[model samples]
Target: MITITEKEFKQLSEYIKINYGIHLKIEKMALVTGRLHNVLIQAGFKNFTDYYNYVVSDKTGEAVTTLMDKITTNHTFFMREANHFYYFKDNVLPYLTSTVKDKDLRIWCAASSTGEEPYTLAMILDEYFGMNKIWWDTKVLATDISEKVLEIAKNAVYSNERIASLPAHWRAKYFNKINNENSVLIDKIRNEVIYRKFNLMEEVFPFRKTFHTIFCRNVMIYFDNETKIRLVNKLYDHMEYGGYLFIGHSESLNRETTRFKYVMPSVYQKI
Candidate 1:
């Protein structure tokens, strides 16, 4: 495996941080080496600097997309953080239904790693709206930086182990069992989420409609404080007045710097 010199690593690190908002700390050096070893080999790069040059010079985004897929961990599962779902189902849903008079519920899973979180939200919305779902636009906008994971998300297939995190009823109702080891989500549920390749670090949030709920869980862990604060504020601009923000349980907002009202651990409200 090719090794990166300090200078080459710095070049790659700065490029990623500037474009993707990932803070690759010194401890991550070994991870970068291991994760990207095969990429370097397959690209036929003799040295890290050469690989870095090629990645930057590649006009097509495929190079960077591959870089993100390898370096950025997309570790998520259905209902991985169950408590946030409970809060969304019990509290957020009720509030959104009662107040969002147009029934156009705009929800964004800003870090939809492989679609579990957005799909879970879609199922909950289906249950919450039930027969009246036909009257509402509950389509969820799910985005991730890596096109690779977005493809996986669009596939809508999961192993039995990955599917096991969902409720038993969800397993029966929303999925078509493929056999003992895999299942595919029913079209009714699968069609509810729209997947996109989006970078949160983009200066402007592009959607014309502000979201009523944003589930940007776990992804911010890779960002530094300044990046997180900037992204949080940008997200704030794209949310409705009474919108809810659900982050990872391990993450918290800086009360001093953010505009979101504290609701609970990993949950905040835009007042």
Candidate 2:
């Protein structure tokens, strides 16, 4: 088995931090080694230095893409953080429905890992609007840095165990049973989410209209304080006035530095 040396780990971790804003601590060395082991071996790299070199020097960008895929953890389930969804439905959706005069409602799932979060939002939107959904545009924008997860999310298939936490009514209404073990999101819900490959560290967000709601949960734990603040401010700029931002329950914005008013634990609003 190959192992990453201290120097190689530092260099590679710094590269990831600088380019992707994902801060890796000294303790994550073993995790870095474990995740990248197969990629290095398959690419014929004998040491972490060689793998790091290949990742930086490759002009096609696929090397770094693969690096990101392995390094980032995409561990999420349907309704992983249940309270945020409840608040979104109870408070945020009502505000949006009342104020969005144009009838076009926008929501962005900035850290959409596989598909569950965005699909859940889509289902809620469909149910909220019900028959009136025909007259309104309510597509959810889902994006992630990892193409591997994006492809899986786009497929919209989940194993029975993966979806066991979702409400039973939702399972029956929004998914078609693929088998005893797997189910696929129905086209009605699937069509309501648009998935894209996006990196939050990108200097400019490519969007024509600001979103009414943005769910950027869980992913910020990988970033250091400065990176997190920068990302939070960036998200602020891309939001419509009175828009809601739902972050992970574990994450908090610096009270003084952020413009978003705290609405509740892990929930903020642009006012």
Q: Report lDDT per candidate.
A: 0.92, 0.93
TM-score of each: 0.98, 0.98
Backbone clash count, each prediction separately: 0, 0
In model 2, the clashing pairs are: none
lDDT by residue for model 2 over 39-110, one digit each (tens)? 988989899988888889999999999999999999998988899998889899899889999999989999
Please give the lDDT score at residue 233 for candidate 1: 92
Residues 216-240 of candidate 1: C-alpha lDDT, one tens digit per residue: 9998999999999999998899999
Please report, as a residue range, the 10-residue window in candidate 2 with the lowest summed lDDT.
249-258
Clashes of 2: 0
* RMSD in Å for model 1: 0.8
Instruction: Quote model 1's TM-score.
Output: 0.98
Error of 1 at 31 (Å): 0.9
